[model samples]
Target: MDGIIVRRVIPSDNSCLFNAVGYVMDHDKNKAPELRQVIAATVASDPVKYSEAFLGKPNEEYFSWIQDSEKWGVVLTWLLLFYSEGAIELSILADYYGREIAAYDIQTTRCDLYGQEKKYSERVMLIYDGLHYDALAMSPFEGAPEEFDQTIFAVRKDRTIGPAEGLAHNFVKEQQRKRSYTDTANFTLRCGVCQIGVIGQKEAVEHAQATGHANFQEYR
Candidate 1:
């Protein structure tokens, strides 16, 4: 309760979610491939649970798509170019690791718990700023090294969530004040494959669908 909780930034190599989750789960940021395999295995082991209706695509497609390190996106109502994970992945991970994953959204300042109803003994925190995921950890003192930070907390530790939520609120507020998140609805993007300019998320989706180009880069 007396520790300083800080946001641990993760790389934006299109695997930030997995890396952040890995950091919070194991203090290892390079566990993306293993974690992806875990998700694939979990899904494969439960075809009925991770069916087309739940996965938004055929089970086989999602299995390969998630395993492919070069591929991304979760196929929500709309698609972003570099999305690595979503609620579905979070749920799978929660079950796989037997820990609740609390994701605090910077845009909405809402904490979404992946394994809320489950009986998990531990919980890990992640920060979501619309497009990227970062980890939250508690350090023993100010400016302490990351090696001393604690990323996982006991589920019954009522003190942990309070500080985590406070820090998340302040951090998200500051980020919002600076307009730090990409406005997917209105952000300008250029197709990396064909070098065609696209406006907004809808236009980007249309361009990708029409031209079969999945690569896109944001441009102001």
Candidate 2:
């Protein structure tokens, strides 16, 4: 996809997107109001985008980023209205770029570029307050994937063991430990649902075959 920057305008920014948004605002003093209306209408048409951008995310994928663009547009337009009040006039964000950069007064004032390991680009913010603090930059991926659990299938893939022999220990002791003693794929299943790569399918079939014979007994 083509690379594009999304940001608010601020003092001394020299970036293309910053200047473009700032120029638009300067030409039409009421452009902020119009931008807001456009944003509201656009957002109304696509609520998913608004929600994804404002909130952390619906998921860790590009679709979420694209959906959030609508809300980003709304914030950008709203920020332009603050030019008179010295509020952050713009925030520059590039969805395609591995890194993100922002500017003040048409100049690249602040830039955040990570090492090659970064999966996605960062967000650039604008601050118009006279206090001279840095424009707030927040990473969406931060504090994500807090909960990582393995399923029953995952265990079998990790360790070369079948459910029957492997389950002997558990059946004898009937102990349940819900912690990752090994890697994500190797950990023992805490329960039936959590069994995975470690447990072979043959064991299950053999057990069923041995136990089969219609053992159903109805109580009167």
Candidate 3:
């Protein structure tokens, strides 16, 4: 990998994880909800395979909540292994927060189960800073920074670069510096109708209902 670059998705949405996965997989962000449904249904339909201990919730309830847009989490890496009958490599940015955490890797290979064997190739990198998720990409760069191409950032699971441990450390440090002067007293939510700023999710939703504003954006 030479002169790698990371392309960031739009921020401040509860769907960051799904959107990040979609961006890396070359799918529409809107498809995330559907993918979530498929994962949930797959788990629900076969509770014996995806045991309660693994799912961490009752099959039906977990299935319903996972499909909700506001629910922002995933057990897809495991689910994908079962769905595709293949392998998956998940690389996580461990020290994204101001903490000393060990960077780790999870490799899940297809196993002989139900006498079903299929072949597929998929690998994904997810960047988590304890709160948000983002995708990463690296490619050769020869053009000016301003004129750098975006298509080059598409997902390429088969290709990988360095561990980039230094990059993770430096990014956390920069975030910490920015936080020192940032006032994060309350989560801000902006109404879509009148564009009024409200604090807290409950209050924001109440204000929206009262003012006939159904849309809102959250800023943390």
Candidate 4:
């Protein structure tokens, strides 16, 4: 591995994926909207190729939804990787969901709409934590760059530091405590059918059963 440094992008309004991609491409965060449009257009043009199984919605509807500044998921991940490969002519290695870093190679069996094959010769890396994204850049270190298996490094189980583990544990505990407190607090459920506010789960359930209003949203 070379002295590859991971850079964090500033948190945006749930636009981490866009920010991360922009940072890696040496572009401003504003590029996210354009990138989203590109991806939407690509999917829209060839709905059969990038079908509902990957897009998670009807093609046009999903395209409109993804254009908004929101958190992206696996669908956008693959779309962005494919788009970047074509745009920049680089194979991208994405560290996804803190589980695995997979490489998307454009120089592979990627067939285009016209059934044309294209190939790229460069590679880059991006990091994802199932919530946010970041970029990784490699530069000259003090010593020589050591060759290592990227697959092993990507899913290494022993990579978590002790302090990181402790902090993660504490964070989970805190979240649990907060959830418990919230659960105990008074909650109002608004029925989707009748639009009536019912207090408490028991009352809400009873109301739903009585009125056949199965849909509800919780309010504090």
Return the top candidate by lDDT: 1
Q: In model 1, which range of ten residues has the least summed lDDT?
A: 73-82
**lDDT tens readout by residue for model 1, 1-220:** 5677688999877778888999999999988899899999989889999888777668998899888776553233134333333888888889889999988776667778888778687889898876678898888888989999888877664534555557656777776677766666777778777889887777877877788676777777
TM-score for predicted model 2 compared with the true structure: 0.22
Candidate 2 lDDT over 137-217, as tens digits, reads: 222233322122111111133322233223323322221133211121222221122222222223322332454321111
Q: Model 4, 12: alpha-carbon shift in Å?
A: 3.9
How far does residue 205 in candidate 4 sit from its true spot (Å)?
21
TM-score of candidate 1 against the unseen true structure = 0.85
lDDT of 3 by residue, 94-175 (tens): 1111111121111211111111121122233444543354554443453434233232221124332234433433444554
**TM-scores, all models, native as reference:** 0.85, 0.22, 0.47, 0.43
C-alpha lDDT score of every prediction, in listed order: 0.77, 0.26, 0.42, 0.42
- How far is 85's C-alpha from truth in model 1 (Å)? 5.4
Which runs in model 3 stand beyond 4 Å of their true positions?
A: 73-122, 139-220
- Model 1 stretches astray by more than 4 angstroms: 73-85, 157-160, 209-212
**Two-way lDDT contest, 1 vs 2, winner:** 1
Residue range with the least summed lDDT across 10 consecutive positions in model 4: 88-97
